[model samples]
Target: GDDVRVAAFGPNYANEKFTPRCTAVSMGSSNNVQRELCRAKVLLVPTKAEGGPLVAAYAWALGVPVMMHNTGIAASCQECYARLTGDAAADAATALSIVRGADTDPRWQRP
Candidate 1:
Protein backbone atom coordinates (compact mmCIF):
# COMPACT_ATOMS: atom_id res chain seq x y z
CA GLY A 1 0.00 0.00 0.00
CA ASP A 2 3.07 2.26 0.41
CA ASP A 3 1.12 4.59 2.72
CA VAL A 4 -0.49 5.85 -0.47
CA ARG A 5 -0.40 4.50 -3.98
CA VAL A 6 -2.46 5.96 -6.84
CA ALA A 7 -5.52 6.57 -4.70
CA ALA A 8 -8.65 8.36 -5.79
CA PHE A 9 -10.60 9.78 -2.91
CA GLY A 10 -14.00 8.15 -2.34
CA PRO A 11 -16.85 9.05 -4.63
CA ASN A 12 -17.23 12.76 -3.89
CA TYR A 13 -19.40 14.28 -6.54
CA ALA A 14 -20.20 17.43 -4.63
CA ASN A 15 -16.65 18.64 -5.20
CA GLU A 16 -15.80 16.54 -8.25
CA LYS A 17 -12.40 15.50 -6.98
CA PHE A 18 -11.03 12.58 -8.90
CA THR A 19 -7.45 13.03 -9.95
CA PRO A 20 -6.12 10.09 -11.82
CA ARG A 21 -2.45 9.07 -11.72
CA CYS A 22 -1.70 11.40 -14.60
CA THR A 23 -3.30 8.78 -16.81
CA ALA A 24 -6.33 9.01 -19.06
CA VAL A 25 -9.15 7.07 -17.45
CA SER A 26 -12.12 5.90 -19.44
CA MET A 27 -15.10 6.56 -17.15
CA GLY A 28 -13.48 9.08 -14.83
CA SER A 29 -15.31 7.38 -12.00
CA SER A 30 -13.60 7.05 -8.61
CA ASN A 31 -14.92 3.71 -7.46
CA ASN A 32 -11.57 2.67 -6.03
CA VAL A 33 -13.12 0.78 -3.13
CA GLN A 34 -14.92 -1.62 -5.41
CA ARG A 35 -11.90 -2.06 -7.65
CA GLU A 36 -9.70 -2.74 -4.67
CA LEU A 37 -12.16 -5.28 -3.34
CA CYS A 38 -12.11 -7.11 -6.63
CA ARG A 39 -8.31 -7.21 -6.82
CA ALA A 40 -7.55 -7.62 -3.14
CA LYS A 41 -6.96 -11.03 -1.60
CA VAL A 42 -9.54 -10.12 1.07
CA LEU A 43 -12.23 -7.50 1.59
CA LEU A 44 -12.11 -5.35 4.74
CA VAL A 45 -15.42 -3.63 5.44
CA PRO A 46 -15.39 -1.25 8.37
CA THR A 47 -19.10 -0.74 8.26
CA LYS A 48 -21.36 -1.90 11.09
CA ALA A 49 -23.97 -3.40 8.86
CA GLU A 50 -23.51 -6.11 6.27
CA GLY A 51 -25.43 -9.27 6.89
CA GLY A 52 -26.17 -10.16 3.31
CA PRO A 53 -25.00 -6.95 1.76
CA LEU A 54 -24.68 -7.05 -1.97
CA VAL A 55 -21.02 -6.21 -1.56
CA ALA A 56 -20.50 -9.18 0.72
CA ALA A 57 -22.38 -11.32 -1.73
CA TYR A 58 -20.10 -10.08 -4.48
CA ALA A 59 -17.03 -10.95 -2.44
CA TRP A 60 -18.42 -14.37 -1.66
CA ALA A 61 -19.15 -14.95 -5.32
CA LEU A 62 -15.75 -13.68 -6.34
CA GLY A 63 -14.02 -15.97 -3.87
CA VAL A 64 -12.71 -13.03 -1.83
CA PRO A 65 -12.83 -13.34 1.93
CA VAL A 66 -14.44 -10.46 3.86
CA MET A 67 -13.35 -9.30 7.32
CA MET A 68 -15.35 -7.01 9.55
CA HIS A 69 -15.79 -6.25 13.24
CA ASN A 70 -19.20 -4.82 13.85
CA THR A 71 -22.67 -5.74 14.99
CA GLY A 72 -25.67 -6.78 12.91
CA ILE A 73 -23.94 -9.36 10.75
CA ALA A 74 -26.09 -12.37 9.92
CA ALA A 75 -25.38 -15.78 11.42
CA SER A 76 -24.28 -17.08 8.06
CA CYS A 77 -21.18 -14.92 8.07
CA GLN A 78 -18.43 -17.34 9.01
CA GLU A 79 -15.88 -15.09 7.34
CA CYS A 80 -16.85 -12.09 9.47
CA TYR A 81 -15.55 -11.15 12.91
CA ALA A 82 -16.33 -8.85 15.81
CA ARG A 83 -13.09 -7.41 17.10
CA LEU A 84 -13.39 -4.44 19.45
CA THR A 85 -11.26 -1.36 18.88
CA GLY A 86 -11.36 2.43 18.66
CA ASP A 87 -7.78 3.21 17.67
CA ALA A 88 -6.73 3.59 14.08
CA ALA A 89 -3.63 1.56 14.85
CA ALA A 90 -5.78 -1.27 16.16
CA ASP A 91 -7.99 -1.09 13.13
CA ALA A 92 -5.01 -1.33 10.84
CA ALA A 93 -3.58 -4.17 12.86
CA THR A 94 -6.88 -6.03 12.82
CA ALA A 95 -7.36 -5.41 9.14
CA LEU A 96 -3.85 -6.57 8.41
CA SER A 97 -4.37 -9.63 10.54
CA ILE A 98 -7.53 -10.41 8.63
CA VAL A 99 -5.73 -9.94 5.35
CA ARG A 100 -2.81 -12.11 6.40
CA GLY A 101 -5.06 -14.72 7.93
CA ALA A 102 -7.14 -14.91 4.80
CA ASP A 103 -4.09 -15.51 2.65
CA THR A 104 -3.70 -19.06 3.92
CA ASP A 105 -7.42 -19.79 4.30
CA PRO A 106 -9.19 -22.22 2.02
CA ARG A 107 -12.64 -20.81 2.78
CA TRP A 108 -12.50 -18.76 -0.36
CA GLN A 109 -11.58 -21.65 -2.58
CA ARG A 110 -13.63 -21.58 -5.76
CA PRO A 111 -15.99 -24.30 -6.77
Candidate 2:
Protein backbone atom coordinates (compact mmCIF):
# COMPACT_ATOMS: atom_id res chain seq x y z
CA GLY A 1 0.00 0.00 0.00
CA ASP A 2 2.85 2.34 0.80
CA ASP A 3 4.40 1.63 -2.57
CA VAL A 4 1.24 2.63 -4.42
CA ARG A 5 0.57 6.22 -5.39
CA VAL A 6 -2.93 7.52 -6.09
CA ALA A 7 -3.72 10.63 -8.10
CA ALA A 8 -7.16 12.15 -8.40
CA PHE A 9 -7.93 14.26 -11.46
CA GLY A 10 -10.92 16.53 -12.09
CA PRO A 11 -13.40 17.97 -9.59
CA ASN A 12 -14.14 16.36 -6.27
CA TYR A 13 -17.79 17.27 -5.91
CA ALA A 14 -18.15 14.93 -2.95
CA ASN A 15 -15.32 16.63 -1.12
CA GLU A 16 -13.91 13.26 -0.14
CA LYS A 17 -10.82 13.16 2.02
CA PHE A 18 -7.81 11.44 0.57
CA THR A 19 -4.86 9.71 2.17
CA PRO A 20 -1.51 11.44 2.27
CA ARG A 21 -0.29 9.28 -0.59
CA CYS A 22 -3.08 10.48 -2.85
CA THR A 23 -2.41 13.59 -4.88
CA ALA A 24 -5.11 15.81 -6.32
CA VAL A 25 -4.29 16.53 -9.92
CA SER A 26 -5.63 19.68 -11.50
CA MET A 27 -7.34 19.46 -14.85
CA GLY A 28 -4.99 20.72 -17.53
CA SER A 29 -4.04 20.28 -21.15
CA SER A 30 -4.50 16.99 -22.98
CA ASN A 31 -0.74 16.55 -23.02
CA ASN A 32 -0.63 16.86 -19.24
CA VAL A 33 -3.38 14.28 -18.92
CA GLN A 34 -1.53 11.94 -21.24
CA ARG A 35 1.67 12.40 -19.29
CA GLU A 36 -0.12 11.34 -16.10
CA LEU A 37 -1.68 8.34 -17.75
CA CYS A 38 1.66 7.26 -19.15
CA ARG A 39 3.10 7.00 -15.65
CA ALA A 40 0.21 4.98 -14.25
CA LYS A 41 0.37 1.25 -13.69
CA VAL A 42 -3.43 1.02 -13.86
CA LEU A 43 -6.30 3.42 -14.46
CA LEU A 44 -9.28 3.12 -12.12
CA VAL A 45 -12.53 4.85 -13.01
CA PRO A 46 -15.04 4.38 -10.18
CA THR A 47 -17.85 6.55 -11.47
CA LYS A 48 -21.22 4.82 -11.47
CA ALA A 49 -22.73 7.21 -14.00
CA GLU A 50 -20.87 7.79 -17.24
CA GLY A 51 -21.60 7.26 -20.89
CA GLY A 52 -18.05 6.40 -21.85
CA PRO A 53 -14.92 7.82 -20.31
CA LEU A 54 -12.54 9.23 -22.91
CA VAL A 55 -9.68 8.75 -20.44
CA ALA A 56 -10.24 5.00 -20.50
CA ALA A 57 -9.64 5.02 -24.22
CA TYR A 58 -6.46 6.99 -23.75
CA ALA A 59 -5.29 4.53 -21.09
CA TRP A 60 -6.00 1.60 -23.38
CA ALA A 61 -4.00 3.21 -26.14
CA LEU A 62 -1.11 3.67 -23.78
CA GLY A 63 -1.24 -0.02 -22.77
CA VAL A 64 -2.31 0.79 -19.20
CA PRO A 65 -4.80 -1.50 -17.51
CA VAL A 66 -8.18 -0.04 -16.52
CA MET A 67 -10.51 -1.06 -13.69
CA MET A 68 -13.72 0.84 -14.15
CA HIS A 69 -17.30 0.82 -12.88
CA ASN A 70 -19.53 -1.48 -14.89
CA THR A 71 -21.31 1.14 -17.01
CA GLY A 72 -21.11 2.56 -20.50
CA ILE A 73 -18.30 1.07 -22.59
CA ALA A 74 -16.95 -0.64 -19.51
CA ALA A 75 -20.15 -2.68 -19.39
CA SER A 76 -19.45 -3.99 -22.87
CA CYS A 77 -15.79 -4.69 -22.34
CA GLN A 78 -14.96 -8.23 -21.24
CA GLU A 79 -12.06 -7.47 -18.93
CA CYS A 80 -11.05 -4.98 -16.24
CA TYR A 81 -14.45 -3.73 -15.03
CA ALA A 82 -16.34 -4.22 -11.77
CA ARG A 83 -19.90 -3.81 -10.60
CA LEU A 84 -20.06 -1.12 -7.95
CA THR A 85 -22.76 -1.54 -5.28
CA GLY A 86 -22.75 2.14 -4.26
CA ASP A 87 -21.18 1.23 -0.91
CA ALA A 88 -18.08 3.33 -0.50
CA ALA A 89 -16.14 0.90 1.67
CA ALA A 90 -16.99 -2.11 -0.46
CA ASP A 91 -16.28 -0.27 -3.64
CA ALA A 92 -12.91 0.93 -2.34
CA ALA A 93 -11.98 -2.62 -1.37
CA THR A 94 -12.94 -3.83 -4.81
CA ALA A 95 -10.88 -1.09 -6.41
CA LEU A 96 -7.87 -1.98 -4.28
CA SER A 97 -8.07 -5.63 -5.27
CA ILE A 98 -8.31 -4.68 -8.93
CA VAL A 99 -5.28 -2.48 -8.69
CA ARG A 100 -3.30 -5.17 -6.92
CA GLY A 101 -4.28 -7.65 -9.58
CA ALA A 102 -3.25 -5.31 -12.35
CA ASP A 103 0.18 -5.06 -10.79
CA THR A 104 0.77 -8.80 -10.95
CA ASP A 105 -1.52 -10.07 -13.71
CA PRO A 106 0.22 -10.84 -16.97
CA ARG A 107 -2.87 -9.89 -18.99
CA TRP A 108 -2.58 -6.35 -17.68
CA GLN A 109 1.09 -6.13 -18.61
CA ARG A 110 2.15 -4.24 -21.72
CA PRO A 111 3.70 -6.18 -24.55
- lDDT leader: 2
lDDT of 2 by residue, 1-111 (tens): 526667776566326466444665665555487778888877778787899888988887777877677888887886744566778888677667767677576556654
- Encode model 1's per-residue lDDT on 15-94: one tens digit a residue: 42433333333435565545665666655555565455556666667677665655445345654443545677886665
Superposition error at 24 for model 2 (Å): 4.5
Cα lDDT computed for each candidate against the true fold: 0.54, 0.71
Off by over 4 Å in 2: 13-16, 19-31, 80-104
